[model samples]
Target: MNSARRFLLSFAACVALALGMAAPAAAQPFPLTFDAGWNGAGSPPLPASGFWDVQANWNNNFQAGTSNNVSPYAYYQETAVIGGDLVNSVGDLIATFAPVTVNVRTFQDTLGTSASSPAANRRAVAGVLVQNGSTLNIQSTGRLSVLVTYGTNGATTGLPTPGTGSVAVESGGMITIQTSGQLNVVDNIDINNGSMTVFPGALVTAQSINSGAAGTIALSGNASLTSTGSTTLNGTTTISGPNVVFNSGQVFMGDSTVFNPVITGGTHSIMNVNGPVTMNGTLRPQITGVTPTLASSWVLWDSTSTNGQFDFSDDSLTDLPDPGHRYNVATTTVGSVHGTRGLLIVENFLTAEVDRATGAVWLRNTANTGGVNITGYQISSASGSIDAAGFTSSLDDDNFDGG
Candidate 1:
């Protein structure tokens, strides 16, 4: 080859080699990098791991791509918000990331005392949509409350479908779901060792709720919860403490169930059952036992031979002008109430019938075995005395003597 020809050929060969060498280097994966102290610059997109957290103060909102990650290592010094849900063109809005822990620091715990960290309510997350499989771990003793809200639009609209995700409140953490909105979790939940509190008039629903070994649902301290659905609490439920109350309207069918409610310490609680309760285990309380006071209400009790001591009367019995009646009991079954303690009132009149054979008394004329058996005895107090025949005669039994 001549000089010019050789030069061109040599240059082409060098260019090909350089291009080949750069190909692999350009394809190498790089770690995600973003500015933490600033916001409004558009949330940096994350990989399949949709991990994100807010600790101190983030005024702006964060937007995620496929899977992302955000960890706020300090207390929320300012208000921080998550931008929007991640939905690709093909159609998938999954925000599954490795567990995220927003460490909440306490100045008192650090310098005040010798302890560096004290469990308090400093590390809490309020208002946002936490992608499914994302965990908000309350790492420090500082408390952590996660506020999850579903928008009118986007993947977080909470459509009840399969493949839906959840925001797990793991151990060393205490999360409170404040939204009355429903969270559609296609999978199960894990709240074994953590503390979770959902304030009054709040409704929480899950695909399945399974707590600690034996399915324990402890109503700790003065905290109270009102939950609905089929729950299996295998642990002891203490329903006492002046402030501890759990008004659970749970109804379980007749397979086999367990409840662990307590009223010990100084806490107080009320186990209210709106529907049927079937407990295969025991109905235990924290104190000595449940107390039934005279009230203008119906105490409906339905149990097999396994049911313990209970007192139920008609609602009219406690229908005075003042003082509403209340029933008290302690039990280990955490899903339903142990008993209903009051008179069942219906319409204007209070009707009750006592059963002899079954010992199951009922009101509204549904307990007498064969018609209203008066026992052929009359109570004649003054003029209202029990004659030789079983008849009610007196102002006490006289709604209408002629009839």
Candidate 2:
């Protein structure tokens, strides 16, 4: 059966069981709580081996056993006072058998003074799989780190493939990496139809991020994501969604890499990049309904350095605003524009100008010459002007014969 159907069935079973049970004559029993440690008084300990769902060791540490599978439809609402760790010494931390929800609230522990203490052991091995509608929520005011890595074996015979054993935050559910929480994935994070929210003061680092067409990642407050590799956006997805606002923090999209994400203007939403933004793909800045003035329109690239290139090869800058409105793509230093077959259609007027003092703009055609295909380029300004400045050709034999 599908994941959604399975989750519904499991939830129904839990409700039925709760309803069938007789209520206590006095007070209701409290929910089970698991403290951070291998052994403690009145603490629900984890198991040592076998499946994690086994009831033999209910007061042990939460360890991912050799089977690498947890109980299906199991929900753990853990209020950890000293913080808990989910260690995996073997294969991937798979939750595919059933949908599991882990609500973890971590606090400061006074056990050891070293960096690697019992509180610092909140980690997993061979990556984490939240597929089949599983959800992992981590809320903390202190540090809570989880690093998903591959074993000593290579990818050929490794327990999980490099960048293959991804943390799937599938759709219809939520996986929250709250403030003071850090989750580093060695592989790609596939946000396939799921909702993953990274709150401010939290860090989520991954090799790459493949956001599905229907998946939504709400990067709000001061939350930051550092992608060591590339981030590919598929389907019809926007960087900002309802209740999703990105006002602060830097989202470093690697160095000298072309990162493309479809962006739309919303409340306090802007595409803010700190390093060089080399966009070889299309940057669809949707302009409809509202008029886009110079100050109110979207600012595509606000680079901090001079070595950035905005390549518009096979790109389309669509739905340009009406007359008297402008869409600006500005950088601090030198910014280059490449248009092999790309088109910039404006409804009124379009000015591709650069700051004459601190910066320079380069516009070149497919041959890297002054020749540009602005044949159908129409500007609603008086005289319909098309200005091409700072033109230079590398071909020694060719000459500029016409004015």
lDDT for each of the candidates? 0.31, 0.38
Which stretches of model 2 miss by more than 4 angstroms?
1-100, 107-122, 142-166, 171-173, 235-291, 294-297, 302-403
Best by TM-score: 2
Tens-place lDDT per residue, model 1, 1-403, is 1123323543553475567643213222111111122122232353222223332222222333212323321122111223322233344444322323222322211111111121232222222232223233222223333322111211222221112223344344444433231222323344554434443333334444445433234444445354444443433233334444344345332222233333333224434544434443343332323332232222222221123322332223222332222233323332323433322222222244454454433333222222332433322247743234543333333322211
lDDT of 2 by residue, 147-182 (tens): 322212121121222222246665654567788766
lDDT of 2: 0.38
Residue 60 lDDT (model 1): 24
Model 2 clashing residue pairs (backbone): 44-59, 45-58, 45-59, 45-60, 46-60, 46-61, 170-194, 171-193, 171-194
Q: By lDDT, who's the top model here?
A: 2
Error of 2 at 45 (Å): 19
